[model samples]
Target: MAETNDILEVAKMTISTSIKCNTVRGFIGWHSCDNICMDMHDVLDMCEDAFKRERYQESLEADTYVLVSGVKLASCADSSSGMLTDVIMRAFELIDLSTQTIAKLDAAMRKHALSLIIKEAKKKAFDGWDSWRYELLEKAVCLCDEKLAAKLEKLLDIFLEDIENDYMPEYKRQEDTILRYKLHRHLKGADAVKDELYANLYIREMCIIAVKDATDARNYNEAEKLCLEQIKKEDGRFYRNTPEDWNNILFDVYMQSGITDKQIEQAKKILLLGNEGFWDVLKRLYQSQGIWESQKPILLKELKQCKYSVCYRSVLVKENEKKLLLEAVTENPYNLFYYAQFLVMDYPNEIYELCANYIREQCAQATDRRLYKKVCKDLLQLIKWKGNATAKLLVDEFKATYPRRSALLDELQKVEKKL
Candidate 1:
């Protein structure tokens, strides 16, 4: 019974050795079958008793058979099927093994066993799904093999089509949080993965990105299209609130698209929105359209209503005889002197006479030398018209206020002679 136990123990050890050898050969065969013979030769040199023993010889034979079989399996791999097979083969070849036992194996049996092992490996690889299938497909395209590259291209198109049509709609919502999530998932790189999937997913974000890309590429038509789409979506909400943002973007799109009139119209709409800050933007837009003459009245109106002294002064100095200046002086006589001076250069005798009458009326309430000078100047210019007697009354009133200045009185007397 002891002897029987000893024999069973040896049998178990032999089977264990055989299994180890088989596993190593199968691994190496799949990974580097061309180098299998050399690898096995090196493994055989390390085994002591196994090299001499017939049991060791059997194990070596099994391993060689598995290795050869694995090689044949690897030979059948195409780009789609090769990735997993390559990984399995590499794992096998890289493991530790007894060299001596490998050497004693019959070369022919080893080759056949390797083939059987590889055939089994090919079966396993074919049966299971590889996690890196997409990655493999990508790599295959760079291989410069036209057939494989074309296949990968088709596969990517189908895969992307499936992704777009199948699962992209779940991301569409007015909520920022959900839109951000969709953007994060769908946009992987500069390729715009979502472009193919949905016509308008995270539309605002899409429009912004498309506009930026198109602009960078100098594709003004595409940029304009995206910007217009954004405007259409804005639907007056932009006009009511973020008018500047809307107008600024629209201005850029129109300018880039060579649509000067559209840009000016958008600017006018912005000005009508009544945010005084938008005037500068409107000015720029108007200048871009070469329509500053048309925009002058709008700017002057804004200046007339403006309470800021600096805003009023700035506009008055820049535009000397703008119609709003006349209107402003007529409505608010505090600026009458400035308006009178501006009109001297801009208006002729008849308009000047009207301005003088307005000035005389305002001065009747509170007389100042500036107003007196404006009225006297208009009356002297319009002395031949029937309005000269009214100018004489104003000069008599000025004389009463400043009787000491006879030189000015002498000038008024000379003016009556001209009338």
Candidate 2:
């Protein structure tokens, strides 16, 4: 961990310095898998340098990664003049792109020697509708084709006017759903080319919109039907929209359409399939039936499948809840934070054991003081929650176990007085 931290720290410093001064060689050699997203700001901050050095290809790649690396940025389809503009301008300079390419035959003679870069890009397979490169090229082409640009701008205006005048409210919502469907299909298209565009965000958005629309219209049956239709359509998917989106919408459908024992049980079975954020609704479903205790085991299983222990956040560590916390801790002692923090007052002994046991495990395995310092502070908080001399046991164990860690002891002492 220290080595990893050191490498990242050094990389940040080197990248930052390179950005401060135009150092193309420093950038060309330093960037790789490890340092790609080390700091996007750092990577993007180097665009001007690459562009200045006439490394037009390198400039375009950097701009692409920073601009469209995720769904949130890619879905915008807006952003008129940002990093994309900066890189495209440089590409145009290198290629000497101008309206002459379209209108004046003599203007072709003004092409830069580096115009071959655009020539190579034009050979690559990409859709103008979906490709960021195509979007950039369209903007660059506008600079040279003033008449075409005006027509394109006018068409865009007409399209916006059509949308605005279409429904004002009802059609607007339908357009929202249409946008989500567009994204859902686009993600499928991206999958064909092996691109990673979080299709789930759009899928989930569609489900949420349908639910909202149906509820507002006081048409639960229609909402339920819509949700089921979507779930059927999204039965198989790319890697993005899974457990959370479907479970949330499905749960909503079941509840609004009259949640039955059969439906709740089916939802439980569906949740067991693997999910992320629908635990709350699942819990609500269980509680509605007054069967929460019997259903916790299933909920825990679903939470384990997720990346967080937050599924059990509403559960308290009592007689009935002890096993849940213990199971959570066994999965990740860090889970102790999620449940044990709540246990601090009523379940001090359990909190003490959890803190001491995890701290011991951590002390044995922890080599880096920098990382351990955080654990140490967190342990101190757990110990202080004891608010009695039992806290001393954890303090002594910590001090004796990791004697070299004066920082840990200092943190313990800082809170010891408060306790």
Candidate 3:
């Protein structure tokens, strides 16, 4: 039993040391082989168990052996082998390998390792391998000594050359090639390249980019020139004949260029052709010109163009056309609530008869407490304001419609009592 235990201890040590050495050499060996070959999991378990047992020396030996064995395998493996050979080799240099052992590594071995890494990187790039390429580049950059970083930068230039020579024209298969080039130029910090790219681009896209770039650069004169050129190239019938398009561009140019009020007036005359939608733009322009009174007639015309029921109801109240406002309220008697309010402030006598008629019609239709309360409130206010002859009739209608709402009826009754 003692002899068996002694052999087991020695065998464990040898296995541990071998694993450490292999791991340092950057290779993951086969899972199953002859007795001399270790399973990856068995090696890992032995290392872990040794640590758990507080066998520190044995653990260290195991780790070193794994590292060295891994390195030896890596040295012989193909470039495309998916192990981290380069990292492992660098780590070996940092380990406590004897100077003689380190010196024993041939120049060809070091060169072959580096070549494998580069070859793997190129292969990854060719395979359209995004994940591995980025990972490999990052790892390579990290491992590079200061001297190697400079060399790596040169290598990057070569990679970019490869990309340009082989990939660029093929990659830009779309009609938006000029736009793509402009974008790429901006990213690359190549202003001269961008300018050259812009020169060959489609005229419309070129004009747009030039104007945008100039505006962004605060070159106002250049931006103005580009904008004018763009405007000239636009189909005149579309831009000049359409008030909306003309006004939009004119306003942008006017605002951006800080044109004088007189210049703006001229631009507006050229742009606005009295289209119904131009009412808002005219109002804004006239307001800017401090000519609000001149915009009132246009506002009335706009109110007349509101053919939709919701729009007609909404705008008629605020419009300058008293005739339209009165007509709309007469057509939809509920609109009299708004008309009554407007008349109270604006045309007291003219709306007195209209308000009285509205109250009579609303009371006849008031079938619910809510509707009755609404009519009652408006009727009482109109009656109080004008003391029209129908005030007594409105009071009677309120009482008849909302008998259950006696408190509200009493409120209306109080108004009659006050009168």
Candidate 4:
């Protein structure tokens, strides 16, 4: 049972050592395991055990130490930093839960914890981890007195103020906008923040939350407005392409509202943006409206003109348009191995010729061991499709053309055995 002063001293020393050494040990040995999430929950169970044993002080000190350690560790952590921050929040949650019993004994415990949190929050802000700083400040507000909470809220308001400078990094601006959106929801209440959120809908994170909030509230009108405004704003921004995410949101709004016509329109935009799921959705919508025959060619033509090659090729396969698939293969012979399987049964001779020509071109450009192995791999594909004759000729051609290249000779000898 560590005393409050002892806990404070240990936390201060831990922070100092971590800063000097640039490394941190796991707090309470909770994060030392492979299953960090499960172990963290076990920490909560330990708090419950302390509560059952009437050891409130022990739980408070332990939670306080972990909260401080989490703040420092999260600051220096790399890939797992966010999870480390979660450890801090969860510790705060346990401390908040235990405050009732602990306050009866020592009323200053909460204030002490709040002071330490505020101190760390200020350090984090000075260090430019503004996002982490905002989170700590928010937690501090919850554990403080009314006056202190008000002051903390004011500080948060000032912290989130937008910088009007043009030279700020785009990612920094994005991070600030996200924090501002969060602060707006906290200060203005969720309902009142919607319009402000809509105003900043150019920020992708805010737009996602705004759309989700509207849909979650069953305010389909607001959801539709948000999605449409964002979609319209983003139009022609990405090489004249539609905004895919907002379009999908609008499509969902239409589906929920039973607006088949709007669903069809939004579905086409989403499909053109390379979401293959919308192809079937469009097919269903068109069939529902009895317009598949009239709409099919229009959709296919739009897909063919799409800048996304995968979208075009995928739809060609879905529509079973062998001629267009063959055309795609002709446009890029490297696609021979991919589309050849689909085309070989009907156009066996054409596929064999494509395979032979493609293998020859690959062999002509082969300059290294890796490329030579790749050519051999493609030769195996030819043999798989019963193009043994073509494979034999290509292997013979490789043996003659690159007689002095030892790596190619080795790869060709392996292919000849398969031939």
Q: Which 10 consecutive positions of candidate 2 have the poorest summed lDDT?
A: 109-118
Top lDDT hit? 4
Say which prediction, candidate 3 or candidate 4, comes out ahead on lDDT. 4
Q: Number of clashing pairs, model 3?
A: 34
Worst 10 contiguous positions by lDDT, candidate 1: 135-144
RMSD of each: 30.1, 16.0, 22.3, 7.0
Task: Write down the TM-score of every candidate.
Answer: 0.29, 0.39, 0.34, 0.66
TM-score of 1: 0.29
lDDT of 3 by residue, 1-419 (tens): 11322322554565556555544245534421122243433454455455455443344344344444444443443424334344334323322222112223454432333343445445422334333333333333322334444554555455555554544434322222433344345335446665665565344445555655666676667766665555566644334344344334444555566665734463444323333344455556677779868766665555455444444444445345566766666676666666566655566765776777777677667666687667767766777776555677667766786577665675677567655
Which runs in model 3 stand beyond 4 Å of their true positions?
1-250, 257-299, 306-335, 397-419
By TM-score, the candidates rank as: 4, 2, 3, 1
Better of 1 and 3 by lDDT: 3
How close to the true structure is residue 366 of candidate 3, measured as C-alpha lDDT?
A: 64
Query: Which pairs clash inside model 2?
Result: 99-144, 200-241
Clashes of 2: 2
Error of 4 at 174 (Å): 7.0
lDDT of model 2 at position 219? 77
Q: Assess the local accuracy of residue 345 in candidate 1 as a C-alpha lDDT between 0 and 100.
A: 55
**How big is the positional error of residue 335 in model 1, measured in Å on the Cα after superposition?**
16
TM-score of 3: 0.34
Best model per TM-score: 4
